[model samples]
Target: MLPNPTLDQLQVFLAVAESGSFSAASRALNRAQSVISYTIANLEAQLEVPLFERSGSRQPKLTEAGTAMLEDARRIVSDLEVMRARVKGLKEGLEAEVAVAISVMVPTDVMVDVLSEFRERFPSVSMRLNVGELGEMIDLVASGISTIGIGGAIVKQDDSLSIERIGHSFMMPVAAPHHPLARLNRPLTLADVREEVQLVVTDSSGHTKGRDFNVLSYKTWRVSDIATKHHLIRGGLGWGGLPASLIYEDLQTGRLVALELEAYEQGEYPIYAIRKISNPPGPAAAWMLEAFRASLSRCPNLEAFKAQLPFNRSKDAIAAE
Candidate 1:
């Protein structure tokens, strides 16, 4: 192991290197000018090196070796300060920090509620939240780029990850209340749905891999964002499937209406709390996951949503694979 220099010695070295004058360093350190000179001299003596030279000036200048050592000394000083700060934070129960990635389809209100509850329970933990789609969130969590992922569950299985199904939501066909189909007295058949232009929301890459609801195989028009999709649907431009939780008020107020599709597939993608299998979450991350689970429990829409996503195999069994 390498010998470690005292904090006092490193401080004096940094002061002299930064101020470039022993007298200036003495003033900065609130010590006598002789003390700064003696500290540097003793440090050089112990290390057996010439750290500075007079170079025809009253104040010394760093030698080549001293310039090189200064960089390393600066880094070491920074690391020590960071370590001290982290220790102080931990002792005060303020060390918690987490970065979270969430899906945009989840309501802003839901996020606010989760954050409110989480802050109340763990006021020390500072969270950084990023909202995007499922694929972006998956990439972030899988790469250890994010501490926890919140959003729609992965439809496919990956051996490198473990997904915990913390909650579920239902997808239902919706259209603007005044749309022609909403006035139809009969149940909507496949042929009827195929005739109407459908509005779909996808990512920037224009990929609609797993999100296509099987109910409508109509002429699909794709938009790149959820907000745009909502606007398009509200404007009566097309029909689309939206989360029931998000559109409940719209449905009740007659701004949007749920379309009844005949012979439609009722499917539910698991809403997961996904984390990489190789990187188990730390305390802050784990607490956030638990908080999400708690949110699901108290949410009134969850019970009906779980019924929609009936699982043949338990989440524990799926995670085991």
Candidate 2:
């Protein structure tokens, strides 16, 4: 009967396979070269196969059998790591999974960067992410569907939810170059905007069902997401406000022209990180909150907006007032 190989043996085999030499594996694993050779030999004896082609002058190379088994060994080692992490997380009282909802208005590049760091920082903590428009993000947190939410400033204050102002993004009104509003020779007035079709994003959560923000036009086209609004505006369908970060290229390339409207020239939108007051964030979620704040604070456009603002407010003060 074949003997059962131990994890230690498999680990040594993988180290030698990767390092290409038992001596190199010894340095990596902090063990004597003889110990690494002995472990590999035992692993080979138990498996009844020679894993490495032994040569006196050249580096050890994986045999056909070694190549075939390498992937399985890697998978086993990976699964063991995940198991160890989960066990450690349990010991530390960390939640097994954390759900976070992010607003679509948040720059996708920034979101990707922060979440990538988050994965490395908390490998054991599984994440559930939801991207929504307007108030849908906050609704997810308030309704217990998500542990936390990163989104625009909350309009309706509730004692059940805690809000932290992370940063601000600038929203600029824009239209396609061919759109009628863009052709006007002079600065646009409220009457000019009121005559044109305004592309607006509707709240998916129904919390702000009948509310209209910065709506000056009587004729409107409503969409549930920002991408759709951007597409429609680029097609010369209508005009509306979009995050400056999202439309920077469009503005620079003349694909979309900024509207110099009298009533709504440009506006700054506050972004927030929200969580239910009853269910405070776990360690992983708290780490994510800080990651988001740090990422946004470093955004160049947002930094410019910060410089232009009348006064700077700390996150705690913004949350408080």
lDDT of 1: 0.72
Provide TM-scores for the models. 0.61, 0.83
C-alpha lDDT values of all predictions: 0.72, 0.83
- The deviation in Å at residue 228 for candidate 2 is 1.2
Choose the strongest candidate by TM-score. Answer: 2
**What are the per-model numbers of colliding residue pairs?**
0, 0
Model 1 spans with C-alpha error above 4 angstroms? 1-96, 105-109, 203-211, 298-321
Which residue pairs come into collision in candidate 2?
Answer: none
Where does the lowest 10-residue lDDT sum fall in candidate 2? Answer: 309-318
Candidate 1 lDDT, 188-279, residue by residue in tens: 88877788888877654223365665536558888876778788998989888777677766766667767777555546545678888887
**How large an RMSD does model 1 have?**
14.2
